[model samples]
Target: MSQEPGWLRPHGEPWKRVSERLVYDNPWITVTEHQAVAPTGKSAIYGVVSFKNLAMAVLPLFDDGSTVLVGQHRFAHRDYSWEIPEGGGPRDVDPLESAKRELREEAGLEAAQWLPVMKVQLSNAITDEIAIGYIATGLSPVPTDPDETEELALVRVPFREALEAALAGQLPDVMTVAMLLRAYHMARERALPDALSRAMLG
Candidate 1:
């Protein structure tokens, strides 16, 4: 019998928690401070931010190669930001439903097709915030009811133009930038429908 390789051996050691305590919390997020043993045997204190909901974003692509973008003043950055429709969905709720609602609220559009494209960690170093991206097509106009706290501007532009802006740092929202690049990649690689890809690339 051949001996098992060292690489094949189980390496299931996780960060051993020594102690943990709640530092702060709100309806949206919770901060926890933990004393833990690292995999390499070092002991340290870590602060983690836990999100109460999952972030969801939608890229609403039209048949004419245009997409919808929403502009708003972001309180955290203290500046105006242009981004694809996005919102928070409760962990217990379906992300697709949240995406749909965001689209309707932000862009006044409804999509007949939805393709989940990516899942990402927004900030691994300090926050446990997960975001999901979707490509939405077969769109139609719908009534919009934006949240009372939001004062938004909507822009419809060619997909290529939006992508160029995102690449050039005009669109700083992480989800929008990532999803635009992913959509461009899909178009170049023919990962989407033939007509849609052709329209987007052009």
Candidate 2:
């Protein structure tokens, strides 16, 4: 292959092989060391992942147009965090399934309808993690089945209020914020044809 002018030539056969190997990796993430040979040959290692899986956050709008939010203790930051119902187990289950499961598990709510609102990529730096957002309308309260390790509370707030809270970091979950933002715009633009989503836009 002809060398690209702006691109760097690998230091040696070892660096070239490593770079190629890093790009075509499998499930697990990998890192490769390389040095630029053009303007400057600064040595660096690039971390790469084999495209992350998708997660889901279900924002259920009640009959009154209020959206459901969940408050749970986030062990990562040792604080109670507020977010939409969201979780992911494995790729075996569809992202929508994860959304519905999380809604029931965390918020004790079930929706009669669900709509795909947004698809957000959590991190593009190295991993390809995507968060699929859903708008669940026609909600009804139900029994929640939280695990022993989970302490979750359900809050139904106005959609605008929820958006404000999410923007203010009161929701604290990065994935939740990204999902909401994307869904909010979709709802606003009338991109979602569902009647329930009109409440989300409203």
Candidate 3:
């Protein structure tokens, strides 16, 4: 490929991998060290964290312009956080199926309609973690089936309130923030159904 004189496109030599070995391993993730060559042709060492499962998030929308959110304590941050229902799906399994289960478990609701909204790369610098988000509608109640270790608190709030909270950093989860933004965009642009968009935009 030829490069233009003014601006550079993403066409360039990429990093070359000489070798890699697993340094840390767990049921959910693996950390590996690699002997690599940079695009500049220099020897370098790189470490990467690989997830065994795909990340899945579900945002349940109610008819009255409200959505359900879940609050829980996060392990890595060692703090309490509010987020949309989310979990990991086995790599070989369908992500939508995983989203359904997560919504039911965390929020005690099942959605009759689901829309794949976003696919995001989480911290691409060191972790190969990809997240898939969905907008779930037509919610109905079910028994909460949270993980035994999780003490989840569910809240039903207006979608506008949730978006404002995320903008204010009250909801800091990347998946939550991204999905809410996407939902707002879809609602404003009328990408979703008329009734759904009206409810969300209200």
Error of 2 at 201 (Å): 5.8
lDDT by candidate, in order shown:
0.94, 0.72, 0.93
Clashes of each: 0, 0, 0
Residue 143, model 3: Cα distance from true site in angstroms: 0.7
lDDT of 2: 0.72
**Per-residue lDDT of candidate 2, residues 3-121 (tens digit):** 68865765543322224344454453444433323224444565545433467788777755577788888885898888888876456777777788888888898888988877777
Candidates sorted by lDDT, descending order? 1, 3, 2
lDDT of 1 by residue, 26-82 (tens): 999999999999888899899999999999999999998899999999999899999
Supply candidate 3's per-residue lDDT for 56: 95
lDDT of 3 by residue, 125-170 (tens): 9999999999999889999898899999989999999999999999
Which candidate leads the pack in lDDT?
Answer: 1
> Which portions of model 1 show Cα errors greater than 4 Å?
1-13
- Which 10 consecutive residues of model 3 have the lowest summed lDDT? 3-12
Runs of candidate 2 with Cα error greater than 4 angstroms are 1-43, 47-53, 192-202
Worst 10 residues of 1 by lDDT: 8-17
lDDT of 1: 0.94
